[model samples]
Target: MNKKTVKSFRPISWPTKGASAKTGKWRTMRPVIDKEKCIACRICYIYCPEATITPEIEIDYEYCKGCGVCAHECPKKAISMENEVH
Candidate 1:
């Protein structure tokens, strides 16, 4: 039996700062929530890829990518994607 020699392994560098990348500016469309239509089911929060949706169903536009996943997945159709103003 032949034994293989192990080489040095690189350590993964994890980001210490929380979501420093502000990608919202790159978004062409933004999600707007209708309070009246919203049932606060937290469906949008669960579907948000950027995790910008709060527990209260408020979207943090700073980190939101405007992917529209939330709006699409919204059961109540409370979320709407609107054109972002530059």
Candidate 2:
């Protein structure tokens, strides 16, 4: 039988304890979308690092970290970062 050499450390099993935490709880600001101004280009959804922005332009605050990547990358200037009320 031929033997193969291992190249790098690739862990198979991973822990998911804190991986699904709702990061939006600590957000100082949140992205608010203006439906009227939005062009539905999906730029925000593409730029969102957390994958929180949906294709329909709806923001999933549950996992949103409020990094503002979506707002900054929006070409139509439809997404805005506002102070979180709570």
Question: Could you say which candidate leads in TM-score?
Answer: 1
lDDT of 1 by residue, 18-85 (tens): 44567878789989999999999988888788888999988888778889999999998888899999
What does candidate 2's lDDT look like per residue over 18-79, in tens digits?
Answer: 36567879788999999999999998888888888889889888778889998899888888
Off by over 4 Å in 2: 1-18
lDDT of candidates 1 onward, in order: 0.82, 0.82
After TM-score superposition, what is the CA distance of residue 55 in candidate 2 from its true location, in Å? Answer: 1.0
> Once superposed on the true structure, which residue ranges of model 1 sit more than 4 Å away at CA?
1-20
Candidate 1 is scored at a TM of 0.78
Task: Please report how far candidate 1 places residue 26 from its true position, in Å.
Answer: 1.2
Instruction: Candidate 1: give the clashing pairs.
Output: none
Candidate of highest lDDT = 1
| TM-score of predicted structure 2 | 0.76
Assess the local accuracy of residue 50 in candidate 2 as a C-alpha lDDT between 0 and 100: 80
